[model samples]
Target: MPRTRPLPSNDYARRVAGQFISISETRLNTSPPRRLHLNVNILHSGFVPSAWRLPDADPRAFIDVAHYVRVAQIAEAAKFDAVFLADNASIADQIDFRPITALEPTVLLAAIAAATTHIGVIGTASTSYNEPYNIARRFATLDHVSGGRAGWNAVTTADLGSARNFGRDTVPVHAERYARAAEFTSLVKALWDSWEDDALVGDKAAGRFIDTSKVHPVAHRGEWFSVAGALNLPRSTQGHPVLIQAGGSADGRELAARHAEAVFSAAQSFDESAAYARDLKSRAAAYGRGPEAIRVLPGLTTIIGATEAEALRRRDELVDLIPWSYSLNRLAGTLGVAADTLKLDERLPDDLPLPGGGNGNHTFFHATLAQARTHGYTARQLIRALAGGGGHRVVVGTPEQIADDIEQWFKGGAADGFNLMPDALPDGLQDFVDGVVPILRQRGIFRSEYEGRTLRDHFGLQRPVSPHASADSGLTVNA
Candidate 1:
C-alpha cells in the first residue's frame, strides 16, 4: 500500500539549514558564513547578582514592563535570535543575596510584544502546576500579539515548596512527573489545534463568522488530566508556538527527542556538550527523526570586556560580590550530601557514597563534580569558579575572545547555539549586543537582518499543525 501519511517538515531542521545556506551562498549577501543563535537568558533581571545594584540597573526592572521592553528593543536592534525567560513555580529561598523571580513570564512576554518586533520571546512554564488549556491559550495569544515571535519552554517542577503551595503533600515522583509532562504537552497542542487555522471567516455579509464543522472538541482522558472540548483561542502564527525543552536527565532527553524542536541545556565543557548534542541527535534518529530536528543550546554565563585584563577584573568583581554562605548552601543542596560534611578548603569527599536513585538535582551535582575532576580544583576553588550557579560553563574574556570560543564550539559540533546568561542585566546585555554581535554578523556567522518571522522561522522550522488536521484542513480542538 502507498503511504497514507506524508512526512512532517522538521521545524528545527529548517533553521539550521537556513544558516548553512546563508554561510554557503556568498553571492546572495555580503555577510560572512558564520551562524550565531543567541538567546538572552533573562534570569532574575539577567545573570549578574549585582546587576540590580549596577548604576544602570533599575531596582524595580523585574516588575516593570518598560524595562523588559527596552531590553527587547535592544536585542532586536542587535538582531538576536530570541530572548528567553526562566521561571520557577515557587519562591524557594529568598536569601537577599540574589534577585528572585517576580513577574510571570507569559504576561511579561505579552507586554514585551507590544514594545518590540522580530525577536523571539521564549518562556518557561511548568506542567506540574498549570492546567493545559490555560497555557495553550496564553501562548496562542502571545504568538498572535507578537506576530508569531513566541515559544514555550516546557518544564516539570522540581521544587518541593512548589508542591506544598499547590496543595500537594509531597512532590510527585520524577518519572511520574515526566510522564505527566509528556501528556500535558500533547493535551496543550490538541487544545491549540481545536480550531482549524481558517476557522474564523468573519463573513458579515452572510451573518456567518465561524465554520462550526471546522472546530472540534478535544476530549482527552488521560492518566494525569482530562480536558474537554475546544480551547477558547484559535491557532497562533507558528501553528503551535515552538516547543522547547530543558531537562538534562535521561528521561528529559527522551521527551525532547519525541517532541522538542529545540532544547535549553547545560554541560561543563565542550566535550560534555558535544556528547549531549550527539546523544540527543542520535536519539532523534532512533525515533525516525532527523539529526537537525532538535537543536541543542547549552547555557553559558559570560563576562565580556574590551580586553582580557578588563574581562578578568569583571569576573573577579562578580566573584567578590558573591556571599560565601549562599554558595555553600546552594552547592550542598545540589550534592544531596550535607553542608557540615563539607569545609570551604576541603575536597568533595569521593567516599561520600553516591545516591541510590534521587538527589532531586542530579545534573548539577554531576556537572560540578565533572568540573572539579576536569580542572583538578578543590572545594574552595570550585566554589569560587562556579560562583552562584552550579555547573554551567562560565567565560570571562574580551568580546573577540568570547566570539572565538562560541565559534569554536559551534564549528566543532558541540552546540547548535547558546542560551546566554550575562553576568549583569541591562549593561551586560548592552555590552554584548553592541560589542559582540557586530563581529559575528560581519564574519557572516550571524544574521544582520532577520530573514523570517516567528520563533520557528528564526530556527528555520516549519509550523506544526494539529495531528488530525490535514494541510488543507483547519483544526477544531477543545481543551
Candidate 2:
C-alpha cells in the first residue's frame, strides 16, 4: 500500500500552498522532498537562437505578452519547478545582432505570475543599480501576487555599460560591488523580518489589523545604504524570496557562502564542478551555515533529437544560423582580444590574456579553450559547438544520451540540480520535457512527479527562521 500525502491543491492553498504538488512514492523509490528540482531560465524570447522563426514561435515573442505566456504555460504543463528570467541594467554590444527582451524584469515576472499557475517565478535584479527597499518591496509584491512562488536572482552588474545607466562613469570594482551586495542583502532581509510572521492579526472584529509592538525598524547605517525601519510590505510567504546568486569569481563564491540559498555557476568539467561545490560548502561552514543550507546548480544547455546524428545536425544548423561575424565579435568581446587577431584554425594567440587584471572571467575563456584543444576544433567548429556565445556548457545528443550525461553529473556530486536553457524556446524545452525527462525517471535520477509545493520545498530548503527571536532563545543557546 502506498501512503499518499495531500497534494498542494489550490483549494487547500492556505493549509498547503497555492501549488498542486503531490507527495507520493516515486518510481525511483524516493520519498517526500527528495525529488529533483528543475528550473528553466527563460532567456528572453526563448533560449533558441532561431526561436523566433520556429513554426509555433511568435514572431514578436521578443515583445509580445502572449509569447511569454505561451512559454510559461508549457513549463507549467510540464510541471517544471520554476521559470527564471535574467536582466541587465543597460544595453550590451550585441543588441544589433540579437533582439533584447529588455522589459523590466519585475513587471515581466508579474505578468508571468498572472499568466500561469503553480510554477515558480524568478527574476534577476542587480544590487549595484537598485535600492534595497525598492527591491525588497517589488519581490515581496510578486510573492504575494504569485501566491508564494517568487525567487530573486541577486547579481552585481559586471558590464561597464551598466554604470552609465545608473548615473556612474564606470562600474564599481568587483569587491566593492560585492561588499554593497552583502550589506544590501542583509538590510533587505532585516526589513522582511522587521514584522513578526504573525504580525498581521487580521482582527477585523476588534478593528486591529497589525500588532505594532511586534514590528520594528532596521536602522542599518551601511557604507552604501542607510535604510531605517521596516520594509513597507509584510513578511513574504517564503519569509524572503529565495536568494540565488550567479557569479563564479572568488568574491562571488564568498558572497554565495554568506547568503545565497542557491548558486548558478559555470564549470567545464565534473572535477571542476565537484571541487567548486566542496569549496563553497567549506566557505558556508565559516558563516555558521551547513552544506545543506545552499544548493549549487550548474548551467546545462541541451539540444535534443530522436537520433544522435539528428541532434548533432540540429546543433550545427543553429550554429550556422548565427552569422560568423557576430559570433566572432562576441567571442572577441569575452576574450578581451580583437576580432582580427583570432584565426579560424590557429591556436589562441600567445598575446591573448585574461581581463580585469587577473580577476577575469576564467570560466568561459578556459572552457572555450579546453573545448577547442581537446576536441581538435577549428575556430568555426569551436564557436558552433560552443552554442550561442557559449557561456554555458553545450550538450547535444539523443534523449537517452542527454539523460545519461545529466545522471552522471548529478550522481557525481558535480551539481545538486540543473538550470536548463534550451537553444530555442518552447521546442527546445518540449524535447527535453518529452524526451530526457522520461529516461531520467527510468534511470532513477530525475523525478516523475512533484513532491512538494514551494520552490524552497522543491529544493529541500527550510523556510528561513526569523532573525528576530525571544531574548531567551539566544541566551539559552549561548548558555
Candidate 3:
C-alpha cells in the first residue's frame, strides 16, 4: 500500500498568527498587501555591453557555470521569483568586441536549478526553429528536476541572421511567425495536459505503474507542426511550468493575452508602462482571463551608487568604454535603421521607420523612441541612457532614489514588478540586494522570505489543472 499524508481540516483553533487573515477585512481599510515581483536577467557580464572592460569583470563569464550559479544563488537569497536568460540562435551583435549568448538556455537553466533551491529558472526558446513536443518535454523535464520551479519564455526569432542560420535566407513575415507561434504554444499546452493528474497509479500489488487509460494523445495537426501524442513525462508538480512572453508587437500582445501568465515588457516611462499594463490586462480579459491572471513586468536596468554624482560617474564609465561606432550601430539595429543614418550628436530621425518591415521587435523600438523623444536626448545621450544598448529603462541613483522609483512604478499601476537587468553582474546585483531591497521591504512591497515552494507560488499563480482531467471529471478548467 502507498503511504499518504493526511489532509488538513478547516479548524480555526489550530490557525497560526498572521496566516489566516480574511481578504475582505484586509481590503476594507487598504489594498491587500501588494507584492513586487522581481526577476534577474543573467546576461553576459551584465546589461552594460562594455562591462567586460572593467578590471574585475570576467570576460569568460559568458560560458562559466560558476558565474551563472553565483548569480542565481544571490537572486534566490534575495527572494527573487526567477532568473531569466535570453537567447538567440545566431550571433545578433558585433561579437568582435563583446560576448554573445554563449550557452543554450535550457541547459544552463538546468545547471542553475541544480545549484539553487527556490528561484524559478526561466529560459528562452524560439518557436520558429524548435518543435512543440521538444519544448514541452524539455521544460517539463526542467520542472521535474527543479521541483516545479521552471518557466518558459516563448519568443519568435525575428532577426534575419537567425533565419539564415537555420537554412533560410529571409525571415518569415511577422504575421506568419506569430501565427505559427500561437499554434505551437497551444499544441504544447495540449501535450502537457495529455496525461491526467492521477495517471501515475504506482500500484505494486496490482502490478500497475501507470493508468494508461488516463493518458490521451494530443492529436494536434497544425500548419507549422504536426505533433502526434502525449509527452513521455508525467504531469509536473506545477502542472505546467509558467508561461512567459516578451514582445511588443500587436500579434505578440494577442499571443500573450491568450496564453501568457506573465509578460516581460520594455516601456521607458511611467505613462507608457501604465498604458501597456492596462492594455495587456484588457486583452487578457477579452480572452476570459481576469487582469490578475497575468503579470506585467517591465525591464529595469539600475546603476547604483552612494550618491547621485557617483552613480552618474559609474554610468559614464560604462558608456565611454563603448566606442561611438559600436554604440551608433547597435542603437540603429534596435531601431531598424541604417547605422550611417544616425548621427551621434543629433536627435533620432523624426520619421524613423519600423524595422523588419513591421515584423521586427516593436517593443524595444517603440520603448527606445519614447525615451529618446520624451527627453529630447541626442544620439550620444540616448546611448548613455540605454546603458546596455537595449531598449529597457535605465535609472542611475542612490539606494533611496532607486527604491523610490520602483515604488512609484508599482503603486502607479505602471508595473506589477520589474525584470532587473543590473549594469553589471554579481556586484551590481549585490548592490541592489543590499541597498535597495531593504528599502522595498521597509515600504512593505517586497517579500523578506519565500512563502511557497514553486515558481507559481512565488508569483501567486495557481497550479494549473490538466484539461484532460477536467474533461474526464466533467469539469471546466480556467486559465
Order the numbered candidates by TM-score, best leading.
3, 2, 1
Candidate 3 lDDT trough over 10 residues, lowest sum: 9-18
Task: Give per-residue CA lDDT, model 3, range 1-479, as digits (tens).
Answer: 11222213212111311122232234324644779999999987899999888989999999999999999999999999999999999989899889989899999999998888889999999999999999999998898888889999999988998999999988999999999999999998898888766667665555767678778988877788888888897776667799999988889999999999999999988998898889988999998997678989999999999999999999999989998889999999999999999998999999887897787888889999998999999999899889857799999999999999999999999999999999999889999999999999999999999977788878877666666653334333555
lDDT of 2 by residue, 1-479 (tens): 11123223212322332111122112113534344567898776555455555566665667776766677888777777788888877777576557775778779888988887678888898898989999888987888777667888988876777888778886677678889998888877777778655455565556666667657888889799988878776665555688888887788899889888899888767887899899999999998987677888888889988898999888887777777888887777677678888776666665456656544455566666666766677677778777765567888899989888888888888888888888788678888988888777777666655555556656766666455644432211100
With a 3 Å backbone cut-off (N, CA, C), the pairs that clash in candidate 2 are 47-423, 48-423, 48-424, 217-229, 218-229
Q: Write the per-residue lDDT of candidate 1 for residues 15-97, one digit (tens) a residue.
A: 43334334334322463344668888876566755566666677777778787787778888888889888888777645476
What overall lDDT, based on C-alpha atoms, would model 2 receive against the true structure? Answer: 0.73
Compared with the true structure, all predictions reach lDDT values of 0.76, 0.73, 0.86
Error of 1 at 74 (Å): 1.4
Clashes of each: 23, 5, 0
Q: Judging by TM-score against the true structure, name the best candidate.
A: 3
Model 1 ranges with Cα > 4 A deviation: 1-34, 351-359, 471-479
The Cα error of candidate 2 at residue 297, in Å, is 0.9
TM-score for all models, in order of appearance: 0.88, 0.89, 0.93
Poorest lDDT segment (10 consecutive residues) of candidate 1: 1-10
